[model samples]
Target: MSDPHATSPEDVDLSRFDAIVDVRPQAQTRPHLPESTFTPLERLLEDPAASLPSTSARVLVVCDIGMRSAIAARELAELGYQSVTSLDGGIDAWRRHGLPLAGTDSLTPNELERFDRQIKIPDIGSTGQSKLRSASVTVIGAGGLGSPVISYLAGAGIGTLRIVDPDVVELSNLQRQPIYALSDLGRPKVAAAADSVAATTTQTATEIVQGSFDSSSAADLIEGSTVVVDATDSFQARYDLSDATRKAEVPLVTGAVYRWEGQITTLVPNGACYRCIFPSPPESAARLDCALVGAVGPVVGTIGTLQATEVIRISAGLAPAYAGRLLMYDGAVGTFSSVSVQARPDCVCQRP
Candidate 1:
């Protein structure tokens, strides 16, 4: 007989379940069934409304053992999920039964081998990787933050990458933009960034748009992207992208870096926006740009890496950490902190 608390692998029909929601801690290593969606237990416990999708489709919850899965099943049930079940014995029982399992879904032989390690992640299974492969991300600026953002996103298998930048690679750019080499000097930054994206993974296709990000073109550039990344140093560019993205109702991941400090945050359509925190630009003379204030390569790299990480999480259909929070990194002190934010009542972004 099946256990009263959970259903055994033999009793659970995978074909009947529309989706499997893994609620284990990410540190635990377990081979995930193909097409499974990962939502860490803590995330679900803290905010199930945001972490979980609003689906009526039947979902099976699983973990290393049945304990966490049972908890997740109960949480879903309490949330009014019509049909929620726990996989008895979790993945361990499933594997012990010699049942059919797929590490990833819709992956070609080469892709399967290429992303083998990533495919093993319970939350990012084949479906998540497929999402990554089908996503198109546009990154504005190919400078400090853009370099690592472009490189890592491409390496993560972002299928379509559109690099937009009006500047040309310079000898000084080599310090922070390692994606370019000495030979790239004098060449358009978009060209070098596109080339770097191509070299990272054969699965990713690259596009180059040579233009500065401004009010007029920001909307057009961000229109069709799966995600828009703001990697520019200018406040004007950041404000322009923020306004355009908010108006477009598209997700925006913006990053900024000073000499030893950097900040990153994601602005979803209905959530807090960049303007909520800073309604107006800093005083004219008080503004600082990387060119004038200078920056350490690693500081920008840290912020860029975080930006890329958020992009991947967004692509994977996972909630981003910075959605309602601003993450600040202090390279000089080696510390990271975050502050919560909300949409201001009178903010223009609140308008429908």
Candidate 2:
């Protein structure tokens, strides 16, 4: 076995092995092996459970290094396996490298390959990506917050992106709103931002609403949408979005950044809508706008990226990430804080 290629698949250490149970013909990955011990998830993904023995069984995953087996062992536990052990030394280090072992497989459909990168996540897989294609999302505001939100959602292949922004970008907005170049300063942000989304590979379709989200028209804007992002910069609009999204029964990803500080929260269906968190709108403060306080690029960027992440997660059939929680950041101190939130019992959004 000393030849260059023949010297491969060496022996592995078993000192750190959690437990090694060969299930090729035996049993035990979880504490109570079902009539058959094969993972139900695997059954649903590939072959049927009828292919496995009905007595009991466990599986061993062999990798170049035992490290991956160790990691996969943990993965099985998280998937409801009470007892999953790994080979301390990997396949390369195994004494009986040729030992019989049952192997698992993957699903690699042609369409799924386009989203190969996304399907790798546990929270989001090919199944989740499919849900995203069937989901609709509405984003309010097309400035700083909407920039990254639209960009990522588009890049993530969200099925539909609906943007409603009645404002135009001003010359002064180039500081943080990079979606609009200096060349299009006076153009409506909705059009410019919509164009940005239209260029992404994952973006399938987009709709731009050139109007503010008011009481009368909010219903149409919220119709059939899975979620809404409140990236607007006005207190009235934020509150309006909060109220409207609540009635629409869609999760709301709200973002706010001032100077070097930023905060994000999932509202409406996730928790008490924003009104519960901010009981009464802080007395109107005309002087505290991002324009007045001066927001840094990264601050708004941070908030916007999180807003998009929340939107995609919810659309993709994952639980609302920020449900009952708020994430606040202080750039100066680099401190982050999260607090719990509850829905107001008597809020007017009892129906959506």
Q: Give lDDT: candidate 2, residue 74.
A: 61
Residues 1-352 of candidate 1 have per-residue lDDT tens digits of 6544478889887788877778876622335666677788878767766655564767888887788988877777777877778999887688678666565355776775687677667577667788899999999989999999998888888899889999999998898888999989999999888887767788999888998889988777887888999999888788788889988888999999888999999999888888887888877423349898889998999999999999999987778879999999999999999999899989887776
TM-score of 2: 0.69
Best by TM-score: 1
Alpha-carbon RMSD, candidate 1: 8.7
- Model 1 scores a C-alpha lDDT of 0.83
- TM-score of every prediction relative to native: 0.73, 0.69
How many angstroms is residue 97 displaced in model 1 relative to the true structure, after the best TM-score fit? 18
Candidate 2 per-residue C-alpha lDDT over 1-352 given as tens digits, one digit per residue, 9 for 90 to 100 = 1211111233323333333433221122211111223333333223323432221234444334455545555655555544344545543355245432222112224434566577556456555777777778898888888888888888777878899999888987777787788767778888888777776554358889988888778888989888888887877777778878876777888989888888899985646877787766776444237766678888899899989888888887877778889999888889989988887677654444
Q: Could you tell me which residue pairs clash in candidate 1?
A: 38-123, 105-126
Rate residue 139 of model 1 by lDDT.
Answer: 93
